[model samples]
Target: MSHPDTLIAEDLLLLLMDDEKGRLSASSQAQPLLGGALLVQLALDGAVEVEETNSRWRPAKVEARQVAGTDPDPLLAGAWETVAQKPRSAQDLVSRLGKGVREQLQDRLVAKGMLERRQTRVLGLFPSTVWPAADRQHEQQVRQRLQDCLVAGAAPDARTAALVALLAAVDQAHKVVDRGALSTGEVKRRAKAISEGAWAAKAVRDAVAASQAAITAAVMASTAATVSAGS
Candidate 1:
């Protein structure tokens, strides 16, 4: 059976308090309560109220200074009084109190068990479609399956063919070296031979010269582009 839609009274209270203070400044538990967008909305709508804790003292207006040294509970009462007068948005609250103090207050609220969280299907802003909801267990299973597949193979099906082509190219390069089979002394002799027969080594000489010309041209082009862009 699906759970019924419920709003935590503490969360609504905190959001209302944050609205009044222009930021959150409660215990750690209150942080999560302030995070809920729905709770914020309810506080703005004036659907929630802060219950008076002490029966003996029923003052019309509770000053901030009065609850200065007391615990967060009493401060919450004062906050409710202030929020009840004027409803404000979360953004307005943050703007008034500053981000740092607002976040600290949220943390304090969350640390206490007074705040509660519930799941709700909120509408998507951009896509205009309901997001598929999955339970915690289903999400864990999906992650585990994806991890298992990755560990079994280095490359996925689509990339397997490309990997084979790369391996073949490496094998061909190795074959070329094997066919040349020149000893250390032979390699030195070949170098000397090339120097002696410079005209006969025209093919190798032209390749080296072409590479140097391309590099120089590329550097000149890049410099010209940089200068033009700057200007």
Candidate 2:
């Protein structure tokens, strides 16, 4: 199977980022989403498997197992190595696989000319880094794919389906898409449908479900931590 030059996670980062502000729209939730994207991509590439326990006593798990003729990408290879090291629940693997992914992916995109890295100081004191879009050609294509699927009622391919799932998982589908005459609710509903649609294999579906669950858990955990700190 042929894969896009950019990984799903890269595309997702682009989608979630505000091109002008150089900040992610849902910055706090990006980690789980990126990790989830990696898991689904690995499943799509036949580099990993999401095994279902189908029992109340046990949980779903992911195993690293590459197809005979396939060679995983370097970043993916590293994540695959982590998975190969042990069988873990998807939620456990989400944050683990996502660690350092954002920085690495940002640097990769910067080197590829898809984004520009800028240094700024907050209050003229604190140094900060921001990535703004340098090249929008690739991002436009990704948005177009989402447009076709969510607005035009087109059936999405595996990658597009996975992206829809990730965006919907974080409730960012309507925020990212133009929606034209469509209401935000309609766009989100369409996004939800595509996420749950029959466009991928069982393993891929399981991976998507795991990603959604992991994202929810991560968001709740972050919220709880913030509350605790404030209290």
Query: Cα lDDT of all candidates, in order?
Result: 0.29, 0.86
**Could you give candidate 2's per-residue lDDT for residues 87-140 as a string of tens digits?**
998888888888879999999999989999999988999999999999999999
Residue runs of model 2 more than 4 Å from their true location after superposition:
none
What would the per-residue lDDT of candidate 1 be over residues 1-231, giving only the tens digit for each residue? 011122222223332332322332332323322332222222222323223234544422111122223233333343444445554433223122222333443344445432323233335334321112212232233223322322222222211211111112112111111223445344333323322233223332322222223223333555588789999
Q: Which regions of candidate 1 fall more than 4 Å away from where they truly are? A: 1-79, 87-91, 97-103, 106-231
Residue 99 lDDT in candidate 1:
20
TM-scores, all candidates, are 0.18, 0.95
The ten-residue window of minimal lDDT in model 2 covers 65-74
Best by lDDT: 2
